[model samples]
Target: MKKFPMTVGGEKALREELDDLKTVQRPTVIASIAEAREHGDLKENAEYHAAREQQGFIEGRIQELEGKLGSAQVIDVTQIPHTGKVIFGTTVDLINMDTEDTVCYQIVGDDEANIKGGKISISSPIARALIGKEEGDVAVVQTPGGGVEYEIDQVRHI
Candidate 1:
């Protein structure tokens, strides 16, 4: 499987989630299953069925988190040399060329991308265009509405 790039913060978040699933959720589901099993027959018990379904979901999520963590390549933006260019894990300040509206975005992994939080996925059109670009460079992003142009005002590694 191809390894996915992740920021140090993103890796830590995944690790924390994995720990929670293993130490908290897994044990809780197991106990719930045991209690449900003790209550009634295996075939007709609604509680048992529900517990089993919950167990399945918990196990599936655990596996997914483990796989993602195992294949993740964590990159620490702070440790990398600052070249004043846009790169993964870099927070960039931009100005819309058309409207002259200022915006800030942190380029991160797919799992860490949240538009509301000012984080954009590395694979996104805007990030792709910004990669390797320095301040004063213009990035043209192809959006569903149309093409949008942004001027890179600043890049910060944090």
Candidate 2:
């Protein structure tokens, strides 16, 4: 099976969600189904139908989390050795050549990517272009808005 690459934090979050689903949601939904069964007629019982639908959702989520956790390959960014080059889990500071604006982004696995948090997926166009590039190198990314060049100002494996 293919391994799912993820940061330590990302793995922890998935674990927590799985725990909550198993320990809390599963039991709660079971109780709800049981309670709905007490009201008699199975065909016309809205409460029973609703509870079953909710149970389905809960079970599907539980399975998805389990499968993902089973194949997760957690990586620690702080432990990786840095050679002044951009790599997976490295945070790079870049300066836009045209706008002269600075942006810092942490190259992370898909599961750990949150653009709002300044973490970008390694497979993204910009990240792909930045990989293997050293500080002072200009990386060009072809975005939907067109090509943009960014000069690497600093690279930190954090």
Instruction: Assess each prediction's global lDDT (C-alpha) against the native.
Output: 0.93, 0.91
Q: What is the C-alpha lDDT profile of model 2 across 34-72, one tens digit per residue?
A: 998999998999999998999999999989888888898
| Per-model TM-score versus the true fold | 0.95, 0.91
Q: Of the candidates shown, which would achieve the greatest TM-score relative to the real structure?
A: 1
Candidate 1 lDDT over residue span 95-152, tens digit each: 9999999999999999999999999999999999999999999999999999999999
Tell me how many residue pairs clash in candidate 1.
0
Superposition error at 5 for model 1 (Å)? 0.5
Q: Write down the worst ten-residue block by lDDT for model 1.
A: 39-48
